[model samples]
Target: MWDIIKEIITYSLFLWIFLVLSYSNSNQGRILGCNGKSECPQRHRNSTINA
Candidate 1:
């Protein structure tokens, strides 16, 4: 019973770490957008031009 509890805790910690890492990596991409602008306006311009 103790072993099962330990295993669950370990798995939960790993999952939490994985989720945090993934979120940080995704956020970095958005944060480092075109010329370091988080809210790039080029995307909107291109879309409007295409439309």
Candidate 2:
């Protein structure tokens, strides 16, 4: 009986965590820019240009 209860509790906790992460990532827009450009503004502007 204890083992069955433990299994159910574990499954519920795993499902809850999965839902939370899925919800959080839904709002985050593209993490990487197209054309291999850095998404961060500072990194994008720091590239050195040679004359």
Write the residue-wise lDDT of candidate 1 on 1-51 in tens digits: 999999999999999999999987774435646543435554444453333
Q: TM-score for every candidate vs. truth?
A: 0.54, 0.51
The global C-alpha lDDT for each of the candidates, from Candidate 1 onward, is 0.68, 0.66
Could you say which candidate leads in TM-score? 1
Q: How accurate is candidate 2 locally (lDDT)?
A: 0.66
**Model 1: which residue pairs collide?**
none
Name model 2 segments beyond 4 Å from true: 28-51
Q: Give the runs in model 1 whose Cα sits over 4 Å from its true position.
A: 27-51
Q: How far does residue 45 in candidate 1 sit from its true spot (Å)?
A: 12
Q: Tell me the number of clashing residue pairs for each predicted model.
A: 0, 0
User: For residue 12, what is the lDDT in candidate 1?
Assistant: 100
